[model samples]
Target chain A: QQPVQSPQAVILREGEDAVINCSSSKALYSVHWYRQKHGEAPVFLMILLKGGEQKGHDKISASFNEKKQQSSLYLTASQLSYSGTYFCIEGGSNYKLTFGKGTLLTVNP
Target chain B: EPEVTQTPSHQVTQMGQEVILRCVPISNHLYFYWYRQILGQKVEFLVSFYNNEISEKSEIFDDQFSVERPDGSNFTLKIRSTKLEDSAMYFCASNLDREPRAFFGQGTRLTVV
Candidate 1:
């Protein structure tokens, strides 16, 4: 099944902060994060393994909670370039990925 | 700096016709995948290939859709008979191994009429 992402859309000003979360009911082997610009393909951000580790890109960071089957992405001091749609794909033991509906983020200056 | 590359950035074909989207994954990557996104829809995985064979596939990857590693450098997705619903952005991706960080191509914008 696809993971569930919170806050269908978020609006923020430059330098503001926001958090997007994804949760799944199945046992997850990995959680992947990607950002898609308008009318473009999704760009890879980072991946979190089952070991409950976190990865980051500049001010964008993510955490995976192995026990909770949840992951959270944090965007701090956001920039206008950060405005885009964020998607989380959950990979379970089966090695197949189910993606969420996505969270649309708009960061304005 | 290596990234996945796809050809025919945009393709328009009539229904019942066949279409083949090509991709060249990172030179050293062993795992390849095909995914599609219907307009305004979430990206859906079609299939994954490893060891020159399909490792996993989704129900969407029915008989109409097939993937092949035709040669040492090319991976292709062939849609035997195009349908209007097949109009979407088809993306090719590759990974270093079983790792979750997948590098995606610029995508082929398939428009079936």
Candidate 2:
């Protein structure tokens, strides 16, 4: 099944912060976060392989709650360049990924 | 940095015609996959190939869809009879051995009319 992402869309000003959440109905082996700009392919951000493990890039970080079948992406001190759509893909034994509909983030100056 | 590359960034075709989207996965990767995303929709998995054979495929990937590693450095997805609904961006991905982290290609935008 596809993972569910919350706050389908968000708008933030420079230096602001935002969070995107993803939850699945089944257990999660790993959660992946990706960002895509308008007319561009998705770019891998980070992956959380186990519960309580956090990964980050620049000001973007994410946490995985395996027990809850959830993961969250945190964007801190957002920049205009951070404007894009973010998707979360849940992976497990099947190795098949079902991506979330995505969260549209608009960062304005 | 090694990256997956796809050709003909955009393609336009008519219904019932055949369309081939090509991709060159990152060198040294052992697994290849194909995914599609309709405009304003979530990306969907189509299939995965490893060891020159399909490992898994989604229901959306019926008999009409086929994947091939025709030669070194090239992987392709061919739709035997394209439908208008097939219009979407197709992404090719690959991952190293035992790694679940997939690197996606820029994608080929197929527009079937």
Candidate 3:
């Protein structure tokens, strides 16, 4: 099943912070984070597995909670470049990914 | 860095016509996937391929849809009969293993008219 992402859209000023949440009804084997700019492909950001290890990319980070079937992506000191649609994909047992509707993040100058 | 590559940045096909979208996954990647996104919508998974066969496919991948790894490096998705609803940006992705972190291509914009 597709994961549900909260805060359908968010607006932040440069140097501000934001948090996006993704939750699924079914059990998740892994959670993948990707960002897509207008007219561009979704770019892989990070992947969180069931073990609950937190991963980071520069000012962005994510954590996976197997018990809650949820994952959260944290963006700190957001930059203008961070403006895009962020999606959290729930990986199935067969390695197929069901992606969420995505959260539109807009970082202002 | 290694990245998946898809052919024909954009394709325009007539209804009822057959179209084949090609992709070249990262050389070392073992798992391949096909996903499509309609205008202003979420990316939907169509199918996944491994070991030269389809490992999984979604309901969206129906009788008119098929996938193949024609050679060592090329992966393709064929639509037997294109429909207006099939117009979307199709992305090809690959991962080194089953864990995660898939690299996606630029995507092919398929417009069925």
Candidate 4:
């Protein structure tokens, strides 16, 4: 089953902060985050493997909680480049991924 | 940085015609996958191929759809008979190893009329 993402859409200003949450009904082995720009392919942001582990690069970061089967993506000091749809996919056995409903984020300058 | 490359960035096909989308995943990546996205819709999983064989496929990847790793670097998705609903953006992705992180190609915009 696909994971569920909160706040279907978000509007933010440059230099603002935003958080997109993803919740899964089943246990999650790995959570992969991607961002898709208009008419482009989804770009890989990061992947979190285990619970309680936090990973970040630049102003973007994410946390995974296996116990809750949830993950959250944090975009700090947002940039115009951050305007896109975010998808949190749950990776299951055999490397298969189930995609979540994306959270559309628009960052205006 | 090595990236996945897809051919024919945009393809237009008539219904009932066969269409093939080609991709070259990053060399040395151990896994390959195909995904589809309709206009304004969430991406959907199509299939995954590993070790020169299909490791998994989603319900969306039915009899009409087939995948092939014809050579060492080329991965292809073929729709035997196209339909209007099959029109979408097709993306090819690759993973280095056990890590679930994937690198996606620019994508092929398929337009079936």
Per-model DockQ: 0.63, 0.73, 0.78, 0.76
- Least accurate 10 contiguous residues by lDDT in model 4 chain B: B94-103
Off by over 4 Å in 4: A66-68
Candidate 4 lDDT by residue in tens digits, B1-113? 78899999999999999999999999999899999999999999899999999999989999999999998999999998899999999999888787677888999999999
Candidate 4 iRMSD, 1 decimal: 1.1
Task: Report the candidate with higher lDDT, 3 versus 4.
Answer: 4
Question: What tens-digit string does per-residue lDDT give for candidate 1 at A1-109?
Answer: 8889998999999999999999988667789889999778898798888557888979999999957489999999999999999998886543556679999999998
Candidate 2 CA-lDDT value:
0.91
TM-scores of all predicted structures: 0.94, 0.96, 0.95, 0.96
Writing each residue's lDDT as its tens digit, candidate 1 over B5-68 gives: 9998999999999999999999999888899999888999899988999999999999999988
Q: What lDDT tens digits, residue by residue, belong to model 3 across residues A13-101?
A: 99999999999886688889999998899988988885567889799999988574889999999999999999999877667778899
Output the worst ten-in-a-row residue range by lDDT, candidate 4 chain A: A90-99
DockQ of 2: 0.73
Model 3 accuracy (lDDT, Cα): 0.91
Stretches of model 2 off by over 4 angstroms after superposition = A66-68
Best by lDDT: 4
Candidate 4: TM-score of chain A is 0.96
Off by over 4 Å in 3: A66-68
For candidate 2, report its TM-score: 0.96
**Winner of 1 and 2 under DockQ:** 2
Candidate 4 — what's its lDDT? Answer: 0.92
